[model samples]
Target: MGRRPMPVGTYGKIRVESSGPKRYRARCRYRDFNGKVYDVERMGTSRTNAENNLKAAIRDWVTPVAGATVTASTRFRDVAARWLAELVRDAEREFRSWGTIDTYRNRLEGLVLPAVGDLRMNELSTPILDALCKKVRDNSSASSAKTVRAVLSGVCAYAVRHGALDANPAREITRLESKRAKNRPQKSRALTAVEVLDLLKRLDQDERAAKDDLPDLVRFFLGTGERTGEALGAHWPDFNAEARELAMSGNVIRVRGRGRIVNRGKT
Candidate 1:
């Protein structure tokens, strides 16, 4: 009634059609998937194909099942995939930039679920999590691994949020260190007098060379120190040119490229 213990790194092969005495062989092979050759332990005559397949299975290189949606089953890969599909659905309507949705979709399909996809959701453990991390650590950039880790963490979070899992095992994985980014210093750089003069000369040259509206845009940028929206909102009729001052009277700044109202001004 109980399941047999797996031969830690082995498989049992029972002798076929031997009447004199029952005999069996225990075998195992450890083949590295990261570009290493097939190797067998205690079985020099082992078939190459079998060893290859066993190595692939051990490496979690399971091929995908075609046309199967992840939601109908509780497989770790399936759930993770379904969670990402759901995320894409939500993001299509909610996301402001194409880049955000694209990045999320790619990470989900390419990294998060592939390592753990066919596994039953409840069967996921620290060992499985460790293997996934190791896979990412082997070939990906450090930042990329961190990003994939975040994706996997979120995938596990989704499982917990939807009652598919009790706790996210990925939460136990340590975050990858960001080596490429430098911390911002507290001090701000003040322009030197010569630097300021150089900037003025450049600005003057730009004023002479820039077409139609860009020079004015630059001047507006310098004047109010507000973004383009605020400048566009201000009308010449509302300004006293001789006084070099303007009253907004009734105007509002709306950010373009994004659908949101963050800044508005009227005076």
Candidate 2:
């Protein structure tokens, strides 16, 4: 009968031998996930050290998938880079919005990466992620904390997918809470009819407003109640003169590398 192949990601028995006066080498045949077997070896000062080094190497072995280099020992920052690349690809395919991708990248670089970027994939525990979320909530705002939590979850999920982790630690974190809600007062109020008229009169008198066409823009906002992006994205073709109506077809958004573009409007 033919010899059975070793299971993928498993290695054969190790053989240690003296290479020099005090140097030793451990060697083994490892079956990678790609169904190929290769010789793996590590050198150390002593027999025990050589065996231990070989074991460590096997523990950290990862088959590169489509140019990916992530492993169990890969730093969190590296994993985040891979995840961001996937997100950018999704954006390119039109499966995700570039604005959303930009938001994730900004939150990762601005907050999440600075906190745990150096940690290895295997070192990210639930408690560590919980502490990160709490610290962001206390130092920044609840909204910022939520964004950081989401970015962490995404990165950790990517690591899990790549066999770097068994599960996503960020998924076990508690929800972020805002402590300033009780103390903060509301800052926005609807303008009265008289106030609206007064504001328009002032806009007409201001030369800068006239030059910038602010009055017309403000009128368009008030008439349609559409957001700034939606109003700015409107074209003459979207308007129906007979019905005196404009179609809400798209919104103007600025992507990082592509600059401003008209994206499909929210439903």
Candidate 3:
């Protein structure tokens, strides 16, 4: 199938016309949301240069200044992008893993952004955040709603820090306490010492279970209480035989398009 054409005034179209043996002209047309159209025609010694000139013009028109102060008309989408950028930078600097970045990106792009990305920074308010929390809680889990609130709060705080706003409206919003979460009973299934020993004996006797390394893995969990991913990500180097210590340094995360990735320690 053919790709859809770019909107009337939005950038991204490029046409090359030869001006000389080694010279070409790249012409671009871009339209803004206000229905205004702009035409940029540039001539360069090479086709690539001409195309790059057109792209640069498009970026100048479409991309906002990084970390710029928010104004009354600044859109939430703009601020959110900046906030996420800084988050990714900090995460990478700390040797943080891709899973952390992917989680935040998913929550923002899937849940929070759709609900309020178009709102102006100045338009954000406690009522707005309260309604957003309720909407997300109704459709998603309590944990998901809490993440959305955190993302919103982070974006608002970023805006305030950049002098875009005087205060964070999210700070004034009430906690998102879902009835489902509040009414749920706490459950724990700790194994007794005898039960643990019997399970290990049984697993050791079962050839199939032993072949799958289930016995050792189960023993590791019973001994450490570490999560499955954390255990899966553990390495021999992470253990100290002399000190009798183990480093809970990373977790296994399955990214959507990219299979499994080891996330740096939660710490």
Candidate 4:
């Protein structure tokens, strides 16, 4: 079957037209949810700039009337503060592990916000973000680069949700591959039964292990497959003597700036 035609006045019919020598004109037709259609045009010295101009124009057209209050010219740093506030609030209500929140805070404050926090939302483009991701991959580990990418994407998502931008520009950026990611060891070794028993016997004979009850804890961990934090959070009330059953109900975690707290397990 042939493809169906989009309705007239639909958003995102952007095209670039050759102007004078090496110059270009970018134009787009956009129709908002309210059925209002707008024709936008901007001139640029290069085709890339022309395309970017049209995308920016489309974003402004679809933004709600209330978006005018915040303005697309608002600095990303201000938006990042509001984004962090919302993240903290939701994390507290849902009992998310403090480590997760700390990771987000660290990636934003230490990496993403520091690099592009002062730019306006409309000023960001896929090429700009792609270069930043490449720089991060070169300067830091692959894992750190990935985390920073996630933080940047999250910030852009927040802007979209609040109508500061029409879409997340970060989504269109491609990540550079790291040598560590491609060539690192991929296998993990698990202890066999004999090794576990030997380890338990050694723990039993150690004086410090005896004081800490490490042998029993190791046995319990091997038997239940529960994480160390979850095991630490378990208590007598969570076990039933008659049924001989135990509930893996919660996890304990220590926050960086905050104290430790227990939260319900995901499973």
**lDDT of each candidate versus the true structure:** 0.56, 0.86, 0.79, 0.78
Regions more than 4 Å wrong, model 4: 1-69, 175-195, 235-247
Residue-pair clashes, model 3: 3
Which pairs of residues collide in candidate 2? none
* Candidate 3 lDDT by residue in tens digits, 203-246: 99999999999999998998888999999999889899999999
Cα deviation at 85, candidate 1, in Å, is: 4.0
For all predicted structures, in order, the TM-scores are: 0.42, 0.75, 0.63, 0.66
lDDT of 4 by residue, 1-267 (tens): 997544654656678999899899998766666666666777788999888877766655544555244446678888888877787877778756556777888888888887899998888777887778888888887777787777778878888877778789989777656674567787998998899889999999999998998988998899888999888888889899999989877778876666887755333
Task: Give the range where candidate 2 is weakest over 10 consecutive residues by summed lDDT.
Answer: 60-69
As a whole number from 0 to 100, the lDDT of residue 125 in candidate 2 is: 86
Candidate 1 residue pairs in clash (backbone atoms < 3 Å): 77-117
lDDT of 2: 0.86
| Leading candidate by TM-score | 2
How do all the candidates rank in terms of TM-score, highest first?
A: 2, 4, 3, 1
Misplaced by over 4 Å in model 2 are 1-68, 180-182, 240-247, 265-267
